[model samples]
Target: MPQKDYVKTARPKPKAKPRASNARRGNARPTQGANRPWLLIIITALLLGSFGWFLWYLKQQPANPQQPPAEVSKSKPVVDDLPVKPVAEPYQYIKELENKEVQVEVDTTEREPQGPFQMQCGSFRQAEQAEAMRAQIAFAGFASAVRRTEGTNGIWYRVVLGPYDSKRQATADRNRLQQQNINGCRIWNWT
Candidate 1:
């Protein structure tokens, strides 16, 4: 038995082709028209619309010009010149006015004791300071007096203004104290 020999074969090469021209292949110019006419038409339409709007604005404006306001006339008041007469009195006479009134003797009774309302301004540690403030208040034409009272902490000397019947009067007095440049003075209702 003999082995047969195998040989390799070479194939023929392909030739290079030439490039085609665009003009001969009908690919040079554009088939569609230019867009300048459409743009011009849009611009013309916008201009016509704006012109119509301006015409409508001119028609909406008032035709007559504005005029100034008229002046108002003030007339003088007329009064009567006749002599005035007095009218009759409403109350002329009273019958048995003194006889009908009852005559009774007035009783002079003694007045009851009145309790004063005490307003506490502040508690001072020193009695001298309280006394000094009391003196100042007294000198200011106020009937002021100082009283010593015992508190839970210690003894307190209270400077009181008066037994003012009303809180309004007491507040007025307090304001007067403030006007006098007196600090640490406040209104207190002491009943």
Candidate 2:
């Protein structure tokens, strides 16, 4: 194949229109728009009339007119007899429990003394669940015991953490378990 030589062709330049003389430019024809004097007058008159009407309407009435005397009722019902409340007397026995000492009398009807308190974190039907709860409690730095108790409603495995000397200690342990995201632990007397 022979390689042919390519020649670049020149493009035709566009000619500019000749500028008119200053005198002819000044005398150039105005736009041939229709003479609408009636339309212009009517539009101007309407705008002025509407503005005047709005002003007149505003002046005719107040922004907030006072209500007439007949519209407002002068009579309001008066309370004839109001109930008299009896003065509340302060009860004598609401002393500060922490500051005051409470003495319990030993009664003949009381057969046995109160036992140590215990906290039961969970009660499960399966022993494995009880063991898991105990393991969770152990991870939370608590030693727990799982006991299998047979009742009317089948057997139940209880996860307990007690034999606490006082109920306060049991409550504290329960609160600590709650802090470890273990909830629903109730403190009761350990049998």
Q: What lDDT would each prediction earn against the true structure?
A: 0.73, 0.85
RMSD of each: 30.7, 19.1
Candidate 1: C-alpha lDDT: 0.73
Cα lDDT tens digits, model 1, 97-135, are 645767799889976635455555556678998888887
**Candidate 2 per-residue lDDT over residues 1-191, each given as its tens digit:** 98764543355558899998756889755554556577888999999999999999999996667855445446865556978775874664565554788799877785555779888899999999999999999999999999999999999999998799888888888888899999999988877
- Candidate 2 CA-lDDT value: 0.85
Steric clashes per prediction? 2, 0
TM-score of each: 0.38, 0.41
**Most accurate candidate by lDDT:** 2
